[model samples]
Every structure is written in structure tokens, then in C-alpha cells.
Target chain A: MPDFDFAQPTSLNEALELFAADGEVRALVGGTDIVDQLKTGRRNADMVVDLKRIPELQRLEIEADGLHIGAARSLTDIAEFPVVLSDYKGLADSSVLVGSWQIQNRAGIGGNVCNAAPSGDTIPALLSHETSAIVASSSGRREIALSDFFAGPGQTVLQKDEILVELVLPPIPDDSASSYLRFIPRNEMDIAVVGAGSFLHLGSDGAVQKARIALASVAPTPVRARAAEGVLEGNVLSDELIETAAVAAVEAATPISDVRGSAEYRRELVKVLTRRTLGISRDRIVG
Target chain B: MKHISITVNGDQHELLVEANWTLLETLRDHLRLTGTKEGCSNGNCGACTVMVNGRTANSCLVLAAEMDGNEITTIEGIASQGKLNPVQEAFIKDGALQCGFCTPGFIISATALLQRNPDPSEEEIRTRLAGNLCRCTGYDKIVMAVEDAAAMLRT
Candidate 1:
């Protein structure tokens, strides 16, 4: 790794000012992604800013409106957080599934979203919960829907002078439950071949009033399965409807063949994962 | 280079380190704590596992500059005053190690787990140590050693 200047600012304003510099500035929470990227020459930085010291960016709390996840909070903190486990199981589930315990102790969800890998495990879960990104700069702060945050693989809409402060997820309504499932060749320590998350809100008449389905590892970006979501929006849970929705979910993907799996295999995984995640969500709601 | 203060294995040192040097390099080169081995410089392998601020972290992934004001516990810190830690003792008794390159990392990770949960189930032990890969020995004896260490700690 090449030598670079380092900054550990204690305040968000101070950190943003560092980002407001002339040369390339990299903000790292865990160093799980960026450190390797730098060592391999995949990413270059004139100045590396460590964001863990910033107070506001490390905040994790539940407000009246929703959950505010500070960018630097470790995956361990988020996975075991009580509100997350009870109300947002998909977020908790995906958080623990990230890396081994050692990696989870350092990596944070904010970094995962910002890194913007097409196979990022947490994005589909965040989308199911309708999360938003709050970006800050020396100028001011602005919030973008998580669905709209990515530009492409390893790219984000964030400006060179701006840093992501946190992610805010809307409160999960009553009669609702969410769960995430991914297909990995091994039981752990592997990237997702296809990941799926399902959020369902059941109506009084036993029909689905609201639904969200998101998939990963099947496109340039983690994508929402809108057609599958449409299939579930007004229907009750049945083996037949779930089968249809599972097949419909594959329509959102434009997967390419990769070493982990082939394009056709990923498409099949998308359907299987979508069905399983929906089943898990349904089980969580009534059981 | 940047000046930083870090507490390693109950000793404090203020030193200058290149911003690019990883904590693994700092521990092995400057501090002469070579017990922590660097396997994959990337975060994939946990061979360089160490305790940073009481949590297990891959030293190869952390910058030495970031260790400022951080408390570190490397494998050299595990045994105390010529007495082997319970995990280390159990590894010896159960023959859990082979070539032993990965032994230090496995011990550090196991010690951290026992500190948190003194009575972790076998499944819990396997899951917690998933980051540290030991290729020479099948995981059966390693798992047994952790269980033995838990019993040793309880009594």
C-alpha cells in the first residue's frame, strides 16, 4: 500500500471539510473493503479519512419515525440490536450473514451500501424496508432513497466532497414481517449467488395490502422485483401464488455468467430465494 | 509517518508509523510481537487475528495509524507470566494444531469468545471461529479443544 495522509476527525463537520479537499479523499468505516481495494491498486487515495471518530456518523437509534443507522456502526452492533431483530429481521439476518464474526465486528452497513457491489447482501434488505441515505458535505445534507443511491457497480451518486452520514429505514407497520435469504455454495463465508428479501403487510381481509421484493447478484445493481411484488400486492399467500411470484421475480434480473455461478443458474436461484424469503416472511407474520 | 499511542498487551508505546503500514506489520516489525502471523494481507484469512479495543479484528486490514489510543492484545498477550492460557493449554492437550502457523490466530479468536460467553455450545464455538481457517488439522480436535477450555474456565 502506498503512503497517504490520514485524518481522524471527531466531528461530522470536520470530516466533511477533509472530504472537501482537492485530491481524492476516501472515507472508511471498517477498512474491510477500502483497505484491500487500496492495497490492490483498485482504489487510490491522496488522503484517507477514518470516519469512526465522528460522533454523528456513529449514531444508531430508533426515533419516532424510523431507525437511524450511523455509517460507522459495526455489523455486530446492528445484527444484535433489539429493535432490528424484532422489527427488522431481514436487516438483522443480512447483517449477521455478511462475514465471519471477526469481519462483522469491523464492517458496517454504511460501508456496504457505499461500496455498491451488485452482490451486496444488505441492499436488498434495506430496499425491502424502504431505507434512505443521508449524505452530508461542507455545504449541507441531503437524503436520497436507497433505491436511487447507486450509479453502478462500485459507484454511487455521492459527490467527491460529500460523505454518507447514515441510513434511515421507515418503521415496519403492524401485521407486517420481512426476511432475507441468499443462495451460497457453502453455509458461510461466501458471497451470495442470488439474494432475496420479502416484506409483506397483510390486510384485514387476508389479502396482501403491501409488498416489496428485492434481489441481488443478478444485475449490475441490487434490484427490486416489481413484477413479483405486483403479483403479491392484492393476493393471499398460497403455494400457487408464491410460485407465480417467484417466477415473476426473475424478470427483474439481467445477470451475467460469473465464476460463482452461471447466468441461467443465477436466474433459477433468484426464483428459489424469492420463494423461500416470502415463505419465511409469511411464517414470521402469523407464527 | 504519523505519531500514535497504543496499548499492546498491557504496555503502552508511542511510536511513529507509516500511514500505509498495517497493524500486522507494526506488531511484527516495530514492536517485535511476531506471534501474530500475516496470512492473506486481505481481510479474507484471519491468520493475523488480534484484539483491538477488546474486539477481534484482522490486523492485516487495520492501519497502524488507526491504533492510536486503541488497546491491542495479540497472541503474545494470551499467556501470562509463564502460565499458558486455558485455550492454549487445551490446544496442546488435544493436539489441535498441526504445522501451527494458524495456531496463534485460532487461540486469540477462541480466547475472545470465552471472555464473552464462558459456556458457548459447540455450534456457537464453530460459528465464532469461522473466520480463522486451519487447513492442516481437521476442525474436530479444534472444536473439542474449545469445549475443553470452556470447561477448564468454568472450574
Candidate 2:
């Protein structure tokens, strides 16, 4: 790794100013991925603008509309946060599935999205919740829907000058519950082979009012199975509907054979995972 | 290059390093704290584990500049006047180490975990030590060593 400069800004404005000053500067948070990339020569940046001291990006606030999770907030913080666990159990559970306890203590959600891995565990969970990213730049600020955030594998729509400040999770609709399930080879500290998140809303008649099914590690990016979602819409969750939805999920996937698993295995796992997650979401209707 | 000051093992030293220089490199190369081994510079092997402000972290994942003014405790800091820390003593008593290349990191990570959660379950120890890999000893004696050290601390 070449010798470079480091700047730690104490305020968001200062961090933004430092970023705006250098076109080659990269924002550093958590450093879980970037530091390793730098050492291994996978990434090269002339300057690193450290954002750890910026207080605003570390806040987790719950508002009337939804939950606002700071981009710099660590995975352990998300996993253990009471509000997160109570209001967004799927997201909390997904947070704990990342890396290990040590990595979870330091891996930031913002860094996860910014790093933009196809198999990022939180992507499916965030997609199920209808989350949006709050991106800030010196020029202004804007919100980008999480669904539209990722451009491709290991890429996002974030401009080099803009910084992701927070993730705004929309309120789950009434009578709706969500669950995230991922299949991995090992129990701890392994990446997901196939991940699925199911969010289902049941009406008074026990028919599905709204539904969302998102999957990771099955496509170029985290993808919503709209065809599968349509199968559950306005229909009571039955074994038949679940089977159709699960098949549709397989049809929606574009997984490739990798070191983790074969494309055929992932397609089959997609069907199984979709059924399991939908069942979990449907069973939550009892209470 | 970045110039930063860090307090390690109760002593403060200022040094200049690259933005990419990890705390592991800063400790082993710059500060000459050779006790902190560099088995895998990546975070996986965790041979460079250290306590940053009382929290255990992969020193290789942390940039030296990010640790400015932070308190870091390495394997060199765990003892006083050449006496072994209780965890180190337990490691010897339990024959927890064979190659000994990973002992400093294991001891540091285990000590940090036990300090925070003194009465950890066997599963808890396994979970916390997941990042720290031990190729030798098969980890049975290491687990027993941590339990023994916990009991020693309790008494």
C-alpha cells in the first residue's frame, strides 16, 4: 500500500468539506472492508476522510413515520438496540448474522451498503422494510430508495462527493410481520449462500393484503420477487400459494455457480427458503 | 503520511505512518512491540488482536491514524514486573499452547472477553474466540484455560 493522508473530522460539515476538497478522498467508517482492501491493493485512495468523530452519523432515532438508523451505527448496535429488536425484528436478526461478534461490533450498516456486496445479509432485511438511504453532499441532500440504491454487484448510485448519512426505514403496515432467513454452511462468521426476507400483511379476513419478498446472493443485486409477491397478494397464505410464490422466486433468481454453491443448488434453495420465510411470516398472524 | 499519537500499554508514543498502516503494523514495526504477532494481516486469523479502549478488536482492521490518543493494550501490557498474567499462567498450566505463535492474540482476546463477561458460558467463549484461530492445541485446552482463568479471577 502506498503512503497516503488521513483526516479525521469531528463534525459532519467538516467531514463534508474535507471530502469536497479532494476528489480522490474516500470516507472511512468502520474500516472493516476499506483497510483490508487498501492493504491487499484491492482499492486505492489518495486520502481517507475518517467519519468516526461525526456525532450525527452515529445516532439512531425513532420517529412517528419510521426508524432512522445512522449510517455509522455498528452492527452490534443495530442487533442489540431495543427499538430495532421490537419494531424491526427481521432487521435486528439479520444484523446479528453478519461476520462475528467482533466484526459485528465494528461493521457499520452504512459501510455494508456502500461496500455493496451481492450477499450482504442486511440488504434483504432492509428491502423487506422498504428502507431508503439518506445521502448528504456539500451541494444538498436527497433520499434514494433502497431498491434503487444498488447499481450492480459491488456498486451503488452514490456519487463520489456524496456521503450516506442515514438509512430511513418506513413503518411496517398494520397487520404485517416480517422475517429474514439465510442458509449458510456454518453457524457463525460465514457469508450467506442464499438469503430471503418475507414481509406479509394479512387483512381482517386472513387474506394477504400486501406482500414483499426480497432475496440476496441470488442475483446481480438484492432483488424483490415481484412475481412471487403477486402470488400472495389478496390471497390467503396457503400451501398452494406458498408453493407458487416459491417457484416464482426461483424464476426470479439469476444466481451463478460460485465457490459457495452451484447455481442449480441456489435456485432450489431459493424455492425452499421462500416457502420457509413465507410460512414464518404467515404463522405470525396467529398473535 | 499521517502523524498520530497513541497510548499503548500505559505509555504514549507519537509516530508517522501511512494512512493504510494498520495498528498491527504500527505496534510491531513502529513501536517495536514485537510481542504482537502478525500471523494473518487480514482480520480473519486475529493474531494481531489488541484492546482498544478496553474493547477487543482486530488491530489489522484499525488504521493507526484512527487510533490517535486511544488506549491500546497488547500482549506486552498484560504483565507487571515480568510476572505472567493469570490468563497466561492458565495457558501454561492447561498446556493451552503448542506452537505459541497465536498465544498473544488468544490471550488478549480471551482476557478482554473474560474482563467484560467474567462468567462466560462455554458457548460464549467459543463465539467470542471465533475470530481468533488456533491451528494447534485443537482449542480444547484453550477453552479449559479460559475457564480456569475465570475461576482464578473470581477467587
Candidate 3:
């Protein structure tokens, strides 16, 4: 790692001020990703700002609008949170799969989103929940939809002086449940080959009222399978319909051939994961 | 260099650390607490595991400068007084180690699990310890050791 100045900012203002005056400053919460990147020289920083000490940055608020997750809270805290496990189960599921117990205890949801890894397990889950990013900089703050947040692999639209303050997830819909599942070669300590998250709402007529399905590792960024979702809504979901929707979910994927899997295999896994996640959400709602 | 005051294994140490120095490097170098082994140094292997404010974290992934005013527990801190902790004794009884490079991390992680969940199921133990990798002993013995530790601690 390059020699750099380190700043542990206790307030959001302090953090923003550090970034406001800095050269190559990187904001870190858990240090799970940034430390490794720095050690390997994949990323260099003139100064590294630690944000976990800020109290407001660690706020986990449940309000009428939705759940406001403080970006600096550890994944373990988020995943095991009562409200998250019960209301945002998909986020909980994906959060636990980020790394091992050790990593999970240190890694933060915001870090995963900010790292902007195409294969980040939590992105699809957050996207499926229609989450939004609340960012703050020295000048002001801005809100952006999670879908529009990512610029590319390992990139976000967040400016040099901006830090993501919170991720806001809308309230769980009525008659709805969400689930996230990912395909990995090993049982643990591996990145996703194909990850899928589904949020389903059913109506009295035994038809799907609303559907949101997002996929990870299929493109340069986590993407919503809107085509599949469009067809699922207002349709009476049968096994055949589910299978067809799964096939449609593959349309959003533009996966590359990598060591974990080939492009063809990833597309195939997308179908399976999409189907399974949808089925799990449906079952949770009905059961 | 930054001056940081961190409590490790109940001993408070005020030391100067480089901005780029990780908690693992600081523990092994400045404090001369070499019990926390460095493996992978990228959070992949848990050989550098330690308790930060009572939570298991990969020390290599943490900067020593950020740990100021925090309480940390390493393998060196687990055994109380002159007696081995239950987890340490159980590892010996179960013959859980081969090269033992990963033992310190496993011990820290297992001790943490037992602290959090005293009656964790077999699957729970396996899942919790999965982060600490062991190439030798095939993990069965380590799992057995955790189970044994839980039992011993319960008694």
C-alpha cells in the first residue's frame, strides 16, 4: 500500500470536508474491499478517510416512507437486524453471502454498493427492493435511484467529494415478499456466478399484481429484468408462465466468459436463479 | 506516523503506526504480538482474525490508525490468567491442528462463536468457522474441536 494520510472523521461534515480538500481521498467504512485494493496497488490514495465513527452515518431508521439504512453499519448488524430479516429478507440473505463471518462482520452494505462490483451480492437485492442512494458532499446532498447509481463496474455516479450517506428502501408492499439467491461454485467464500433477486406482489385473483426481478454478474452493472417483470405482472403465474419468465430474464444479462463460468453457463444459471428466487418469494407470500 | 491508543487483550497500548499499516502488521510488528498470523492478507483467509469491539474481523483488512480508542482481542488474549480457554483445550483434545498456521484465527473465530451462541448446532459451527481456512486436517477435526469446546464450556 502506498504511504498516505489517514483521517477518522466523527461526523459527516468532517468527512465531507476531508474529501473537499483532498487529493485522491477514498472513503472507507469496513475496509473489506479498499484495504485489499490498496495492498495490491489496484487503487492508490493520497488520504484514506474512515467514516464509521460518524453517528449520523450509522443511522438505521424505520419510517413511514421506508427503512433508511445508515451506510456505515456492518453487514452482520444489517443482516441480523430484526426488521431487515423480517421485512427486507432479501437484503439480509444477500448481505450474509458477501463474505465469511469475519468479513460479514466488517463489510458494510454501503461499501458493497460503493465498490460497485458487478457481482456484488447485495446490489441485485437492493435493486429489487427499489432502493435509493442518499449522497452527501461538502456543498449539499442528493438522492438517486439505485438503478441509476452505478456508472459501470467498480464505479458509481458519486462525485469525488461525495459520500453515500444512506440507502433508502421503500416499505414492503402489501401481499408481497422478496428473496435473493446466487449461484456459486463453492458453498462459501466465493463471488456470485449468477445472482437473482425477486420481489412479488399477488392480488386476490391469484395473479401477480407487481413483480421486480434484478440480476447480478450478468452485465457491467446490476440490472433489472424488466422484460420478465412486465410479462409477469397481471399474469396468473403458472409453472409454464414462470419458466417462460425465467427465459425472458436472460435477456437482460450480457455476462462475460470468466473463470467462474462461461457466458452461456451464466445465462443458464440466471434462468434457474430467477425462477428459484421468484418461486421463493411467491411461496413466502402465500405461506 | 499516527499515534493510536487501542486496548488489546485487556492491555492498553499507545503506539505510533504508519497510515498504511494494518492492524495485523501493527500487532505483529509494533506490539510484537505475533500470535495473529498473516495469511492471504486480503481478508480471504481468516488467519489474521481478531475481535474488534467484541466482533470478529479480519485484522488485515483493518487499519491500525482507525482502531484508535477501540478494544481488540487476539489469540494471545483468549486464555485467562495461566489456564487455557475451553476452545484451546478442546483443539488439543480433538487434534484439530496440523501445521497450526490457521489455529490462531480459528481459535479467535470459534471463541467468538461460542461467546455469541453457546449451543450452536454442528452446521452453525461449520458455517461460522468457514472463513478460517485450513488446508490440513480436512476441517472435520476442527469442527469436532469446536463442538468439543462448546460442550466443555457448557459444563
Per-candidate total of colliding backbone pairs: 0, 0, 0
Residue B146 local lDDT, model 3: 92
Per residue, candidate 3 scores C-alpha lDDT tens digits across A1-287 of 78989999888898899999848999889999999999999888999999999987788879999999989888999988898988888998899899999999988789999999999999999999999999999899999999999999999999999999999999987788899999998889899999999998889887998899999999999999999998899999888888989999999999999898999999999999999999999888887
For candidate 3, write residues B78-125 as lDDT tens digits. 999989999999999999999999999999999999999988998899
TM-score of 1: 0.98
lDDT of 2 by residue, A164-282 (tens): 99999888766778889899997677888999998888898989889888999999998999999998999877899999999999877999999999999999999999999888877
Clashing pairs in 2: none
Error of 1 at B138 (Å): 1.5
* C-alpha DockQ for predicted model 1: 0.86
i-RMSD of all predictions: 0.8, 1.4, 0.7
- In terms of DockQ, which candidate is strongest? 3
* Docking level of model 3: high
Please report, in order, the local distance difference test score of every candidate based on alpha carbons.
Answer: 0.92, 0.86, 0.93
Residue-wise lDDT of candidate 1 within A1-287, one digit each (tens)?
98799998999988989999899999888999999999999999999999998888888899987999999999999998999999999999899888788889999788999999998988999999989999998999999999899888999999999999999999888889999989998878889999999898898777998889999889889999999999999988787888999999999999999899999999999889999999999889997
Candidate 1 accuracy as lDDT: 0.92
Which scores higher on TM-score, 2 or 3? Answer: 3
